[model samples]
Target: MKRTVRNLLALTLVLAAGAAAKADEVLLQSAKSGLYVTVVNGTLAASAQDARQAVKLDTVRLEGNKIAFRDVRSGTYVRAGVGQGTMLATGSPHIRSWETFELDRTGRGEVALRSSQNGLYVRAGVGRGSHLAAVSERARDWETFRLVDVRNAGGHQDRPRPGQGNGNGNHNAGQGPDLSSLIGNYRITHVTADNGFLVPLGRELAGRARMSIEGRGNLSATAGCNSISARIAVENGRFQTRSQPMSTKMGCVIRGQSLVENRISQILTEARTVQRDGRIVTLRARNGAELLKLRRM
Candidate 1:
C-alpha cells in the first residue's frame, strides 16, 4: 500500500505545476571518460523530428548505480556488452554494467542491466557525422565524464561493439575518504576562469552566504540574497548541482543586486570537491582553481 501511494505521489508531482514539493525530478547523466556524454531526457511531448532535429525535453532523471527511478520513463540508458548479435541475454557481464543513455532515437532506450545484457541504447536527435562513441567497458569510480554543450553537439545512432575491454566498472563503496569529513555548508568566495564552468545562476550572485551539505548527497543554501535550493549529486567524492530549484526574490538593487546574482551563479558553477583535514572540510573545484570554505550551517 505504501509503495503504491509513493508511486502515485511521484507521478502526481511530475503532473502538477506549482511551488515544487521537493527536488523530485532527477536527471541521471553519464560521465564520458574523456568527452562529455549527452543524455536523452525522455520521449518528447510533441512530434519527433528527423535524425537531427531539436527535441524539447521536459523532466530528466539520473540513471546511475545504487539509485533508480522506478516511476520515471522506462528508457534510461544502462551499460551492456556489445555482442555479435543485437539481443542481450540474462546473467551476462553487460548485465551488471551501468552507463547513461546517449541522444539517439533508433530505439536506444534506457532499461535495467539487472535484466538484460544488450549494449547501451541512444535516442537520435541532432548529431551529425558518425562518431564511434561506445561504452564497451563499464564505468569505474572517479571516472570523469563531460557534458558537450557545444552547438548541435548531441544526437546520433550508436552501433554495437563486439569485443571490448574487460567489463569491471569502477567501484568506490569502501575506498577513498570518509563521507562525514566533507559534510558542511561552505561559502564560495571566488572562482577561476580555468574552472571550465558555465555560471548556472548569475555572476552578480555574491556576498555573505551559507551552503549546508549532508553526507547523503543533499545540499541547501541561503544566497545571502535569498533562499536557494539544489540537489547535490556526489560521485567519486565530488558534487555537482542538480535541479538547483531556487526561491530567490528578484528584488535587489545596485550592490545588493550584484550580491544576489554573483552568489547564485558561483554556488551553481562551483562544483565542489572537498579535501579533508580533520574537522575542517576544504572544498575545492575539480581543477583546484577555485576553493570554498563550508561550515555547519
Candidate 2:
C-alpha cells in the first residue's frame, strides 16, 4: 500500500509540472488592433489573423519579475531596439537586457510588455505598418495585448467581441473612439498649474487659446502667442506627444500671455489622459491633475 501511494504522488507531481509548462506558451495579440504579434521575414509585426498563424512564444520567467519571450519554432528571442530605434525584432539566441520584458497585467486579463533595456512599454504600431515597437512611455491601449494560450488556441480569435471592453478602458473592443470624435477644433476653456508648476490663468485667454487635432496624429495649438505643432498618439482615452512640439518664436506682447503659452506647450506634451463628456474634453496628467479643459467647436 505504501509503494502504490508513492507512485501516485509522483504521478501527480509530474502532471502539475506539465501543466505549469504548458501555461507559459501563448500567442500575444494586440489589444488595440486585434492583431497577433508574428514574425514576418524575421521582423516582429502584429498582423496575423488568428492564433494558428501567430508565432508561439514561450514565456520564460526570470528574477525581478522580468520575463523573456522565445519563439518556439525559430528558437530565437524577441529583442527591443536600442537607443532611438523603437522597433522590435526577433533573432537573438540568448536572453539579454533587450530581450527581457516585464509583463504589466491589467485586471481584465490583458497585459503590456515593458522592455528592460529602454524602460519603455511595447506598443503595437498599427498606424505605422502594424509593427511591434517598444517606444511608448505609458502602457495604454496600443501597449496592451491579450495572451492566448497555445494549448487552447485552436481556431481562437483574439479580437474581442462587440460590446466587450478590450481591457484598455475602450468599450468598443479593440478599437478606440473614432477619430471624428476628437479630430476637430477646440477652444481652451480652462487651464491650471499643478504639481508646483505655476501658470497664471486669467480670463483674457479664454477664447484666445485654440487647438486643432488633424488626421495622422497632427496637432496644432495656440495659447494667445506662439503656435505649437506636434505629432500625437491617441488610444484608450489617453494621448501622448511624440516629442517636443515646434513653436513659432513669437514674443508675446500681451501681459501674462507668454506664461500661458509656455504652460500650454507643457500641458500638450505632458497630458496623458483625455476625457470627453459631451462637447467638453478635459485633459489631465497621469496623477489625475487637470491640465487643460476645452470645448469642442
Task: Give the number of the best model, judged by lDDT.
Answer: 2
Q: Evaluate candidate 1 by giving its C-alpha RMSD to the native, one decimal.
A: 17.5
Kindly list the per-residue Cα lDDT of model 2 for residues 207-294, writing each as its tens digit.
5888899878788888778898888877867678886888898988878667777777888877776767678776655433346778
Q: Score candidate 1 by TM-score against the native.
A: 0.31
Evaluate model 1: give its lDDT: 0.34
**Alpha carbon lDDT of each predicted model:** 0.34, 0.68
The C-alpha RMSD of each candidate to the native structure, in angstroms, is 17.5, 16.8
TM-scores for all candidates: the values are: 0.31, 0.44
Candidate 1 per-residue C-alpha lDDT over 134-247 given as tens digits, one digit per residue, 9 for 90 to 100: 323343321222222323344533321232110111112223245555566675433322222212224444445556768775666664555666666655556567775566
Model 2 TM-score, 2 decimals: 0.44
Model 2 worst lDDT run, 10 consecutive residues:
164-173
